[model samples]
Target: MTSLTDLSKLDDILALDLPAPDAGAIEAARARQNDLTKPPGSLGRLEDLAAFMAGWQGTDRPTIDRAQALVFAGNHGVCAQGVNPFPQAVTALMVANFEAGGAAINQLARTAGADMTVVPLDLDQPTADFTTGPAMTGAECLDAFLKGAQAVDSTANIVILGEMGIGNSTVSAALAHAICGGTAEDWVGRGTGSDEDGRARKADVVARGVEQHGHLSPLEILAALGGREQAAICGAVVAARLARIPVLLDGYICTAAVAPLHGANPAFLDHCLIGHQSAEPGHARLCGAMEKQPILHLGMALGEGTGAALALGVLRGALACHNDMATFAEAGIG
Candidate 1:
């Protein structure tokens, strides 16, 4: 089947319409967070939490009734450098597994009690599911980027983005370097277990790809070096923001995928909730460029929302504390 490929058409799709967060609502949520059970500032991230929910639902009491995890899987051309152990073909294989509900991400989404959608984006593959469709053109990439936000298919206010591509870190590094205006040496990392030699080789490949295609626009950079997973996650970021849902970003490849969207629309940040910082050197640089403070910093290199999954509990706890915790006045402790 033909996938979404027109950049402009994708743009139309990504131009999703949604409600904006109410300034009054967010301010009220912020106040509630400050007055939560523990002493003020006791729940560091919880502070960010209450506010995030407020902004997400446009209510002082934001409820995470529904959450989604979008796992985008694809292959990378630059993986030929042996930066990753898995072959490029593994991307298509994993996409099939994701469709079959047999991948790590699938299991984690279940564990997290969130709905999961797998889009077999036409990467080097031939076909995929309807929920997540074909490879994106410049416009298609834009569409894919917007898919996450649109996937909610409702007024839900929480979402998490993940990836399942093989050799995607290579693509991530290339995309990062291109958009961040940094050298490959500054953004390449060992993805899915790359050795030193592999890291060096990956960097060299990205440097060359950058020199060859770096001058292109950010979207073009994504289309050129971008994998199917990157495209879909980008779409997810767009959809999440447009819908006023907070997106919990995953590790290197996943986070890198959102770079173009964030650059294209600064307002996107309003709906983002970073899961954690990874040991991946390039990810730190990307995070820096985004000016985000990750929720966890466990030096995690695993992708597929493993970090996000591990960190989801923290968000939940923060939410619980923000909403259920007894105020100091209620406890009469102070």
Candidate 2:
């Protein structure tokens, strides 16, 4: 695991040697898939998904014995700019709902057999408004990033990451615009039912933030434009990569949270799969910018890792077919 005591160490960690998939295990899994009692390539992406799991898990027969889901929540001060329809207090309320097992993510996590955890960064202390300056100081950003890294269960077969924050869609748009390079209007979206006027406001806020921060390194952009939960998501992604764990990223906000890491090192997201393409307009563009294909397209805009939790079922099904199905020789079907 990489020690991240200071924000300055982040660049070093991003540049450090990282693990790659096990070629032997991947080859073995592919061979097994070909031998299964079915025509070649009949299983479509299921076969590819199984091989992906095998490579990451370093096993021909990869299993999702322990799937973990993490949802990080924080309040963004940019809500002061009226970028969202809901108040920032909704963030804390949603966190409580998650803990009480009443949110969509709770039900989806339970159905998918994943252990769910909700980590709420200081709800009482929202990040500074990025329109005025950096959203978080270096110390604050590093603390949240470390908290995210610490939340990962290294023993799990996979991790699903999601987030909850009012006005964070604006934060995500700002981060995406800063990292991916586009007009603020291109990245802004209607978050939590923002009206046309609200979206315009959001775009203005994102544009101003990017202008104030200027062009900097990806990690610096994160500290300048990202909220606590966004920083945490980036940290969790790094920790998961270090542990060689596969990851399923939720929708727009979650994807944007780690966009900086991708900017820093594209290989940083090699082990991850986008859980879904959100209804949020910027999500599709962001995924396009990163050249990642999402696993589902249910028009879901909910943020609490709900999309990733639901995609867990698809992964479980793929593993089941890969690990439990009989071969042609064993079934005497050849």
Predicted structure with the largest lDDT when compared to the true one: 2
Candidate 2 segments whose C-alpha is farther than 4 A from its true place: 1-8
The digit string of per-residue lDDT tens for model 2 on 82-156 reads 888988888999999999999999999999999999999999999999888889887788889989999999999
Error of 2 at 51 (Å): 0.7
**lDDT of each candidate versus the true structure:** 0.71, 0.91
After best superposition, candidate 2 residue 89: deviation in angstroms? 1.0
TM-score of each: 0.86, 0.97
Q: Per-residue CA lDDT of candidate 1, range 252-298, in tens?
A: 77778878766666565667767889888988888888988788899
Pairs clashing within candidate 2: none
